[model samples]
Target: MNYLARDPYAPKRLIEIGEAARGLGVTARTLRYYQDQGLIRSHRLARNVRGYDLAAIEQLKAIVALRAVGLPVAAIRAILVLRDQPDAQVRALRSALAEALREQQAQIQRLAALAEGMASDDAALPPAIAGLQAPSPESATPSKP
Candidate 1:
């Protein structure tokens, strides 16, 4: 079978909650939690069988990413609420994502600076040991052990 030759434009298959959670890198409990919070929509398949739309999988991915970055459920809900109003919310979501990226960049820069400072001073120490040292120059001063 030439799976690589499969069409990219093919329609997405419906996924059950378990499959959706696995695809989105979350637990089935988390999916149930999102459902409880009305963050996602699902439908009943057959006797106690619940199925989710493929679009919900994408939403779950976004939700997982946002949560991974420390965004609260309420804030995530606000963004999901805007999903229905494409014209307005699309711009808002884009702006929010950009802002998040900028914040993450700033945090990375700060950590890098800290790491560089630690590496420059405290010579003759192992990298792992040096990393625990305070990043500030004051901390590098000799003192009673």
Candidate 2:
């Protein structure tokens, strides 16, 4: 039995717009958006049909992942800009990522503390109150509840 592997030469033929969009799990419109942002470049074929190289598909995947994580397109563009530089862009992206991560961690800690406080309050409440004290029609109902 033979298993098919990716064809090393498959990328030689430029992929048409639809094929390229499908490869990147995005609509052609999204690819057009990327083009507008100068994120990916394509070529025109006969009758001006758009075509992209396999490398461009890979770039689209990166763009999707970074955008999904809330990173601005500008940051992603900066990261991509370093791709052609002599030095690795890891250093530039790393500092920004680290600062953002630190802020996120602090927010998480604050949220966890608030949750713990709420849990403590729940624990301290009397069982009757915790279980919901129904009004005898003599007592007023909780305005919030």
Candidate 1 TM-score, true structure as reference: 0.56
Tens digits of per-residue lDDT for model 2, 1-145: 1222244433445677877778767778877878888888876654566677768767888887776665666777788889977366787677657766786788899888766756864356445447985669877764310
Report, for all candidates in order, the number of backbone clashes: 0, 0
Which residue pairs in candidate 1 have backbone atoms (N, alpha carbon, C) closer than 3 angstroms, thus clashing? Answer: none
Off by over 4 Å in 2: 1-12, 86-88, 99-145
Model 1 Cα lDDT, one tens digit per residue, 39-132? 8866654455456766777788888888787565776787778877987777766666777778889999988876776686654655666578
Weakest 10 consecutive residues of candidate 2 by summed lDDT: 1-10
What lDDT does candidate 1 reach at residue 121? Answer: 60
Q: Which ranges in model 1 have alpha carbons more than 4 Å from their true place?
A: 1-14, 44-50, 61-73, 121-145
- Residue 132 miss distance in model 1 (angstroms): 9.7
What TM-score does each of the candidates earn? 0.56, 0.56
